[model samples]
Target: MNLISFITKHSQLPVKGVENTVALLNEDCTVPFISRYRKERTGNLDEVQIAAIVNFKAQFEALEKRKSAILKAITEQDALSAELKSKIEAAGDLTTLEDLYLPYKKKRKTKAETAIKNGLQPLAKIIFGQRNDEIDYEASKYLNDAVPNEDDALEGARHIISEWINERSDIRNLIRRQLERFAMITTKVVSTKKEEEKAQKFRDYFDWSESLSRCPSHRLLAILRAENEGFIRVKIEIDDDKALNNIENRLIKANNATTPHLQLAIQDAYKRLLYPSLSKEILRSAKEKADESAIQVFSKNLKQLLLGSPLGEKRILAIDPGFRTGCKLVCLSAQGELQHNETIYPHPPQNDSKGAIKKISSLADAYKIEAIAIGNGTASRETEQLIKRIQFKNPIEVFVVSEAGASIYSASKIAREEFPNYDVTVRGAVSIGRRLADPLAELVKIDAKSIGVGQYQHDVDQNQLKNSLDTVVESCVNTVGVNINTASIPLLSYVSGIGPKLAENIVAYRNENGAFGSRTEIKKVARLGNKAFEQGAAFLRIKNAKNPLDDSAVHPESYPIVQKMVKDQGLALSEIIGNKEVLKKIDLNKYCTESVGLPTLEDIIKELEKPGLDVREKAKVFTFNQNIRTINDLSAGQLLPGIVNNITNFGCFVDIGIKESGLIHISNLSDSFVKDVNEHVSLHQQIIVKVLEVDIPRKRIQLALHK
Candidate 1:
């Protein structure tokens, strides 16, 4: 198959774009680098389109590899025929290739193999022909010690016939089509596990039935998870009689003495071979689709969470709130460095609210803290109230940050390396403060799945999930443009071409020397060759560089073009920077070349307009309903402000300043159909919601968009 044509048709992108994108991918260019810097060659394709080409290219290669393996295996077996080889080579999909290869695939000893060994293949063929009315005579002629009687001989022939019918691609395809159109997935609770406490969570799937094609990905994943847990028996079924009739119509061409034998063979083939094999194939296909859908959801959520608003380099006093153990407090500098650590007991056990207030005010005044970040965990509300009571020397904004993966980050090796002397509590507090200052930088340190922004994260394909999350992190990091001097190893690692080793080397070089004064100086880092620099240089920013374009998204390869533009305009490079009036007056067509087109020139102009400007908004202070502290305070029809903390296919979960986050179901998102939950809401978006119902015992809250 023509891979470029295949990708073009599938992605619905321009053929030239797909072709050029694939070529660039083969050159080992990263997605961010290609999409951002090679717009001219790629016809201005975006990151998503380039990534699709990458996926399709991989799929084509895998298919070709499989085809070669199958062909080689068949040739080694001396079963490769001209026609058979053509069919195998022409097969575009795995299903078709495997179906064609089914007849030659080696198998364990079965009744069919045993029958064929007994020399009943001839008899099977004769019976399959349906030309002889004397089947008994033929069976008698084939009788031997192994098949002592005509009845046994006929049974053996039928077994061989069943195997032949099972291997027929047309018959298998017919059954597959039936399954694809009419299959229903049903589940039943395991009788032994019916009353188990762990089984209650999946009780909705107990004795449930749904059309497989129409079943939502989340529901299917849930059912599969339940079955994996041994809490339910999942089955995929179609109208058995309808499916068998369709196969018979396609296979049975005659009615004679062989009619009954053929009917028996058909039934055996349908039950013993076709249904089991094809049903499993269909289920697996469904699972792959579900995995892709879940992974897309995860990737989207991770992107939103990573691109979330940053408070941006502010000195912060962050607290990991608790009651009996007291609140763990850490002061962070504007650069997210840990400055001070202590414990403040303002709630329960110690009940030193006065001392805590004094300490917090004094610390804020001393550290010049711009904001306070409190983890939304145990005693959070009490701590917030206590902090609000304190009259600070300066006005301080308070943010209730999500503590979903704070513990994970705190206990991570990276955290330990950052703060060797501090314990997990201090590290966790520091993470909260840094998250408020810049969410993307701090959140990247923890695993994306542990961030609690995805659905069925553990249940999906692990490798695919990791790759997708990593891509999102990489894209977000490159989009924001990392600071070379201050970015942590994890943050620097996601830059276009810099992996962990290069990131470590860059940091080491910086420590040995000093901050990178220009993009040209990055080559001095150990193991950072020209290729890595070419792909990674544009995404790494050097603030206050001698060459100002180093801090912008413009690639160094385009430096000459920018200099020419400045020279042509008869102005200095510094005068042209952020001079939109002058930039708009210059004709972009003058800089167009064979490699650099109008697209590249336009991008360079845009970068010069606002070099290294963050695409994310600044973080704002949000307060939950002060009167509502827990699930009990929530009531139907009450309007409350909430933040969208997590999103899934079904809906988005809103944190309404409570222990249990309320779910705004897809149906409740808008008056019309909500095809995508993201279309209605995004992660970390602050919105107002109307409480629909509150289940205190179950600790579930149902909400609706206030609008």
Candidate 2:
């Protein structure tokens, strides 16, 4: 097969485009680098398109490997023929490949092998041909040594015929299709664990049955989890009569002398071999599909969370709110460096309310805290209220940041290296503050999964999840662009081709030699060679650079073109930067070249229009309904404002100032039919929702968007 052309056809991209993309990918060109810098070569394919090509290329390579193994296995058996070779080569998917190799695959001794050992092969072949009239006499003739009677000889022949029917690829394929379309997924509570408290959480799924095709991703994940926990039994099955009828129609050639034997073989094959095997295969494939869907949703949510609004570089006072242990507070510099730390007990127990207020006010004044970030943990609401009651010398923007992964980050190796002198609480407070100042920068320091916003993340394919989440982080970082001078090692690591080691090198180089003055200077970082620099430079923003475009997203390779444009227009490069009027005057077509087409040229023009622009909107304060403090405080028909904290396939969880977030089901997302919950709300989206149902015993709250 012409793999390049096949990939091009499957991806629906131009042949030349896919060819060039594949070439670049083989050359180790990163997706962000190719999409941003090599637009002309890829026909202006975005990151998503380039990644799809990468995935397809990997898939094709895997298929080729599997085909080679099958060919080798069959040839070793001395059974490889031109027709068999052609079939194996033409096999499209794994299912087909496995089906074709099934007859060749080695297995333990079965009834069929035993029957063949006892000289029932001739009788089996005669029965399959259906041309024999004296089948009983023929069976009696073979019943000499091992075969004692006609019944034994006939049963052995039936076993051999069953194995033959099971090996036919066409029959397997037909039955697989039927299973995919008509399989029913049913679950039942384990008899012994039915009344367990943990099992009650999965009560809805305990005695439920649904068509596998109609099962939603979230619901399927839930059922699988219940089954995995041993609280419920799960089974996938289809109507046997229908399945058998279809299989027989495809296998049985005619209704003749051997018709009864063939019918018996077909029934035995389906019941004993086919159904069990195909059912598992169908369920496994369905689960993988569901996993992909859930992972996509998770990747989207992680991207949004990582790219949440940045408050820019501001001196932030962060508090990891607590009651008995006190609110661990730390003041962070604009660059996210820890300057001071303290503990204030403002809630309950040590209600050193006066001292806490005075201490907070003094710290805000001394540190010149621009924004106050309180980690939304145990005593977040109380801490926010405490800070609000006190007056600072300057206007301080108070933000209750989601401390989803703060604790994890606090105890992490990255956090330890950054704050060796401080403890976990101080590190956590710093994370909260840094998250408020620049979410993308601080959040990258923690594991993507630990940051939350995924359904059954642990249950999905782990390696696939990591790769996907990493892609999302890379995309978000490149799209927003990172300040090289201020970015953490983790944030820098996500910038295009910069891996963990390169990020550390960049940080070390900065530490040794102040800050980067130009994008060109990045090459000085240890091991950040031409290729890595070429892939990474455009995404890393160097503020106060000698060249204005260096601070912008325009690649350094395109600097000569920008200079030419400025020279032709009789203007300095600075005059063109951020001057939309001057940028509009220059014709982008004039700058387009063979290597740099209209796509890159237009992008350069856009960058010149708003040089060094931060694409993220400014962070705004979100307030939860003050009347409600916890889930127990919630009531039916109470309308309250909340922030969308986590979104899943079923619905989004809204944080209405409590530990238990209310879930707004898909049906309640709008008065109309909402097919996708994401279409109605997004992560960190602030909106008002009316309380629909609050089950105090189960600690579940159902919410609906106000009509």
Candidate 3:
């Protein structure tokens, strides 16, 4: 199929770029590594483009595998022919190939097989050809003990003809086209479950009908979930008469005795076989497209959440707030190590506000806490207000972090391994603190789905979702460049070319010996071969390494080029690193060679300008309006500050310092058409929103973007 050309055409990328990227992928180069380091070979393809190539390459391989299996199965059936083989080989898609092989597939007992057993093939063929005028006489000749009458014999012949019509690729394709273009998806509520409290969430889709092609991805996923949960019945419908007439025009040639038989056969095929098979196929194709769209949205959101602004390496005092159980508090070091843990009941039944304030102030002073991270969960607003009243020795920046998956992380196996003596509350508080300090390093320990940034995540394809989320984590991890010495097993596992096993080995070696002194020292770990090092060394940074470039993004193979540039300029490595004036004066063309082009040289210069500099912005403190605390307190047309916590194709959900989050529909996002919700707002972005509507009974709040 000329796989390279096929991939190039589909991906719409340069042919050479696609080919070279495929070659590198074959050599086990990761997307992050190829996009960052192999710019010359891949024609400067970004991570998204390289990922597309990888996906298309996997698709091509899967198609080829399916074709081979089909060929082998047909050959074993002794039904392979030169023309059929050529047709199957030329088929580009799985649907076309399966259609061509339908007639050769084995099936269980059917009426057609029974009719063929009764010697009715000749009569069926005669009737199908439409050349026989004496179809009754021909049918009578085939009557036997099993088929005692012409009526029975004719019915058998009709069954055989129906089977023949159903298996024709041309007829299936015709029905497929009709369904793809004209099908409507309709849903009906199950009478018994309609009044259930749980089913009220899907009440909007109870009696809905829409064009399947025009239905949005989120809506389709919702309807499908409803159907799966037995709250509704879904159906795909098209015009039956139109489909039958189209098949008749192609199959029936004349108006004779066989004409009526052909008409019946066509009707049976359209009703019993063609419509059912092709309708499901079209719906499945639509579902897959919807799944892809949802996954893309999810992956984008995950990237933003993982790379959210970090309060870099600050000693944090984090609180997981609660009302009756008290707030679980933990103090973390600059490196996110748990130092002390306790509980404070500043709010209600045990209103020991004075004691809580005294304890918090003393702890902040004793641990040198620079920031306070309060989890945005139960009693979060009250806790934030209480913390503001406390008088600390230093001016501490208070940040309210999203605690979506903190509980999940606290109860996980990873948490258990890290803290065997601590309870889930303490671990949860620690996670909240670490997330504020370095989100990427701490969030990788939790599943992306549990982070709650996506919509209908559990409804999508699980395997595809996992692969996509993993890719995003890997890309973000490599892009920011991991601190190899302090990184946990989860963080290091996402580094380029390092899997779970190798990450464990590295950690064990470090615990047994000491921290990695340089990039070269990574090779001393058990079974970390050259290939792994080649792909991983550039992304793993050693702080204060003897060789300065080890902590930068420059690959080891290109270390000589950086050295030559430094030597040519007659400056010490220390003076040249982070010296933008000295770097800007150096001529990049002087270092360009066959392997190293202008792109690589320019990248090297930029890295030296800011060695190991974090690409993410610094975290800033945010405050929600104090007047609004719940749905009842909100009013229409009131402007309130909020944070964008979750985004979807429809719109984004904002936390307005309340128990229920308000939603801003896409239509209200701007004055113009909103093509993408992300273009208007991003995850964790702070903005002001006007309350549009508040339904206290349903616990729903609709909002409009005010800024």
For lDDT, the strongest prediction is: 3
In model 1, which regions exceed 4 Å deviation? none
**Per-residue lDDT for 434 in model 3?**
95
lDDT of 2 by residue, 154-249 (tens): 899999999988999888888888988899999988999999989988999989999999999888988999999999999997999998889877
lDDT of 1 at 406: 93
Order the candidates by lDDT, highest first.
3, 1, 2
Whole-structure CA lDDT of model 2: 0.89
Could you arrange the candidates by TM-score from highest to lowest? 3, 1, 2
lDDT of 3: 0.92
Candidate 1, 131-192: lDDT as tens digits = 78878887899888899999988898899989899999988889888888899999999999
Supply candidate 3's per-residue lDDT for 348.
87
Give me the displacement of residue 263 in model 3, in angstroms: 0.9
TM for every model, in the order presented, reads 0.98, 0.98, 0.99
Candidate 2 residues lying further than 4 Å off, grouped into runs, are 254-257
Better of 2 and 3 by TM-score: 3
| lDDT, candidate 3, 370-418, per-residue tens | 9999999999999999999988878999999989899999999999999
Error of 2 at 414 (Å): 1.1
